[model samples]
Target: MGKATGFLEYEREVPGELDPLKRINAWKEFAIPLEEEKLTIQGARCMDCGTPFCHVGRLISGMASGCPIHNLIPEWNDLVYRGSWKEALKRLHKTNNFPEFTGRVCPAPCEGACTVGKSGSPVTIKNIEKAIVDRGFQEGWITPTMPTAHTGKKVAIVGSGPAGLACADQLNKAGHDVTVYERADRIGGLLIYGIPNMKLDKGTVQRRVDLLAAEGITFITKQEIGKDITTEALRSQFDAVVLCGGATKPRDLNIEGRELNGIHQAMEFLTRSTQSLLDSELEDGKYLSVKDKDVIVIGGGDTGTDCVATAIRLECKSVIQLEIMPQLPLSRQPGNPWPEWPKVMKTDYGQQEATKLYGTDPRRYLTASKCFIGDANGNVEAIRTVEVEWSKNPQGGLIPVEIPGSEKVIPANMVLLALGFTGPEGGMLEQLGIERDERSNVKSELDHYTTNVPGVFAAGDMRRGQSLVVWAIHEGRKAAREVDCYLMGSTEL
Candidate 1:
């Protein structure tokens, strides 16, 4: 789709990032954009493989292999290479509702599945995508477009995260009155609070929200279902209801000293930090402070990385991340071949900053927290940890087996649990009499998204459990189509 021999001619190049030491001083996005000419050359690296797996958007061995929203990667790459920036933007928007969000934070499984990457470096698809969309906004090519006509049907979407926003956008485009309800004081759900400002600035999220509002989707903040509003009232008011409320029940460590005063869930730490930052530049002291305190972050994922970065920004004395799993290989193992999301060592932004400052990696692999030790004042003072080896249980499933004489105590005044979420909170689900799957997710079929209730639907993290923002958008768009079909007997969405 790009130059026939562009893959051979051009080496992959991505945008530069600010030095970790300097960037850690402030909470802002630090990725510097590549020039248009360089981005064009990078886009030319998109090979014309007969079968491009970059946009396959399927699971391979339980991991995402490509773009979850099925972005038209090659077409946009070709457009970028041809210097047709406007056309590239249009192609990008055809599949993705918010490229800015995914372009910034998505792990980019699309790059992992790139055809050229099988042999050499892959095309800079993520960077080119961000460039196209950023240019679209800069050139004033993107704007709010009101629906041509109104269907006079109203849809109430619970939750204003990516899923609910995408669903509301699609339903509104179908001429249905769409109103998004968020429990938080602001919209954008996870985008607003769950993610730290350093990764994705709140301004970017709010800009998109503003555009959606201009397009006629109503947004109501600080309105929670089952508490502020009842199920019966919502169903009676709207022609259909879609539950895009995310899976927010965080998994907990049921060990000794779990009730320590200084221990907190990852979301609570991140959410309060962002809120206070926005409210008064953090001078209000409404958020948790780890200044000059040793911090221990549990679980090894994006959330943990974010906690580490936030702690560093807050001037913590020291930070250490605990991971129960073994360290991944430096490159793809034979078992995890091409197109499968590579399980490899990644030094994310947080770890990079930590390495530069501490002269060592902050992660401690194959380590498990035994218990949190507290001071006489009831605040967490330290943590007891143990290294373990993976062993197969009777059922042939792998489990962490504690290694004897490996226990160690580390000083820690604060602990953040980044163990991820279990499932959706049960309040609204229970109130609506919705059935739940074994994993406690909303019981709804893929591509169908209908619950046992006549017009009640579900999508995103609520139905699929915690997932990438791209997947949530895909679910929302699909669910919107189903709701449109249910309402009018068929849909063109």
Candidate 2:
């Protein structure tokens, strides 16, 4: 809630992004920074509605409607509108430890639930949040603060992803001796590897990692709990354990020519690209660069979008994204009510780049891959695909059927399977003997993060399956609270 009459006086606006053609030449964030004065006006656009559904953070009709972390959106918006930069930063850090990441990538369901969005475009909540945090860091307001006194309890966190990082930050704040275990060579799990650096600067990830290192949280990189360090040793050494390994098993395309040389999983491609960027020598003959190659990304979700952007930056000859679902409408449908998140089609940075370059959207909706056409050298040369339609069967579940004579082969020397992820890898879970849900995710009580094993808790994607970074943060905080309670026998979280 910023200004009572501000909604009527001003319209919503966001920062301009870099030119698509120019931005595609390099791996850098495309979104232009909003000026401070403009941010104040954007904050003023907050409607101050009687019911602030923006931060509800609940499930309604099987879809997320608000900020899952229950961020103090209205309070921060009002503070920003009043030009209270420090106050806004303070309110932002209360619920979100890392606003910079969420600001960049979060879908901002809060905006959808905003009262202003009902009538017009909503306030630039995500941009304002990013601006506040960035200003805080620039002004040296964000520094690591070690706990006043250590509780003498040790907590072992498995995974350095968002949830694990949040859990470590909160647990450290609560005076627990926390040790984070990561299998990767560095901290900031997917934030470092899975996400391309152009969208999120690795330097930003390193900055947070350094801050946490200074805050007395011990990070043991290249040390896997189940493999490098035995789970038994961790449980014996630490009073409590929090599992945040994340859902990392990439969903594979099991169709024909699945083992083709040129075809790679989205995570693999992203990982190689990030590693190459991190270490120039790592790019030595093995890395997958789309330079001078025709790139085809399968799946139209965020992962596929990321592939498109990455491929463009790699100077690929062409990039095409195929989605099995039909294209979305431009605006909200009648069925999508005010409180529910709207399913609408819009241009993201990658598609915008593809449009600017190729003169059309990179996505082809309602498309399905039949097989990979490989060259004599065993490398993929093209993709055989056809259009698909979904219909309800006699039972109730919808089934996808391929249309006759719709088959076509598209040129592609490189293909990235951006289909998505399965549950978390089974190494740690099996080593600890934790029970998995039917979907292979760590099964825990709805609100509780505790696994069947005593003194062990799982959260984030590992427990809930693939999800957004904001949800991972929420899961981490909640799991930390539960771990704190399990250790102290009180609701102190």
Candidate 3:
């Protein structure tokens, strides 16, 4: 440890963010970086616990307890505290392929399992990580590196999300040729489109993409395996094929007037907005406009929060987020103990912006939309909602029961369904002849990512269902190791 008593002497601190109301006026990252000295103080807060659980990366009670990619947190913290930033960056990149992405958007399960957090505040691990990588970029420490030797084995990956990129990077480092195919016009599937620029700037995603391209990984955008090229053709050409296409099928509300105009999936709205912003700085007018419109966003998750922020940026007249689940406690409950992800309340950037603009939190908990009410022109005009209470059903499972006489109507000009995804889209899986599990995810063992078909593998959301980007990176790395072994009967990944 850099300083044995540092944890006792220092308190946790993070970088400041732009004022929510002011930041909403433009689509750019709002987090202000902490100075090197302040970040060093934050790094000194890492405890000298002999058994550090921050990198355990295990699931406890169906939630991530630590870093899924098993980041070396304590080592980097020590290095940062000692002012050895270059060394700290090396330790960070040893495990995480994209610290910039995770540092910006990861929920930081590592901090939840942080040993220091058991007693007081957790170390500012996330901010320190971002600082190290961002510094590495500024100092030109990160650049293209050619492999020492080529194994002459070519691999094809059918996605350009975190999982696919991680897999390509690992394979390329192992002296194998790697090609990544993306269905979208841009390289990053989720990072570039599904997430708005306010949360994670598109330039950050593109910078990493360009670096990977310079390192010999081929990127083919606007090419889908099942559509533009057949799965069989891809398999025949490549020595191995790994599927990292994410679970992108948005869950739909099957209520009356769902087919009405002015209602859209959250991804559709986000993707179009990001594409337009990048193409013309939003001058293209290709995205759905919500200006001066009362927007109702259903579903209470990260995606829902993103919708709220995006609507605010577009200058919506009013916005509200409806979550059927009851509000989480301000502190951890009895069921959620130390080292597990705290099921406590958190005010994300989007919610903060809404609060600043509207003078109140825009979230309405324990409320569920009953149906969409439309005007004669077939446009959604309002939403019928009812309050719900969760109770144990006959099967001893929790279920939301609607309360009588709790129905109400809320005016809405646009409705965005931010409900989570069910599973990966079926078209590509069907084309590849891959078997699906009961939950419709690709059938593959956890550590061994190989599917039933020879030379074919699956990883990330396509195999594990919807999950965090860090987990996707872990899956991609594991799958790459397995693919390397399958091809050469051994691996050093």
Give me the overall lDDT of model 2.
Answer: 0.90
State the C-alpha lDDT per candidate.
Answer: 0.94, 0.90, 0.93
Question: Candidate 3, residues 218-332: lDDT per residue as tens digits?
Answer: 9999988899999888989999999999998889999988999999999999999889999998898998899999999999999999999999988899999999999999998
Lowest-sum lDDT 10-residue window in model 3:
1-10
Error of 3 at 105 (Å): 0.6
Residues 354-385 of candidate 2: C-alpha lDDT, one tens digit per residue: 99998999999889999999889999999999
Say which prediction, candidate 2 or candidate 3, comes out ahead on lDDT.
Answer: 3
Q: Which 10 successive residues of model 2 have the least lDDT summed?
A: 278-287
TM-score of each: 0.99, 0.98, 0.99
State each candidate's clash count: 0, 0, 0
Error of 2 at 158 (Å): 0.4
1-493: candidate 1 lDDT, tens digit per residue: 9888999999998889999999999999999999889998988888888799999899999889999889999999999999999999999999999999999999999999999999899899998998899899999998999999999999999999999999999999999999999989999999999999999999999999999999999999888999999989999999999999999999999899999899999999999999999999999999999999999999899999999999999999999999999999998899999989988899999999999989899999999999999999999999999999999999999999999999999999999999999999988889899999999999987579999888999999999999999999999999999999999999999
Reference-based TM-score, model 1? 0.99
Against the true structure, candidate 1 has what lDDT? 0.94
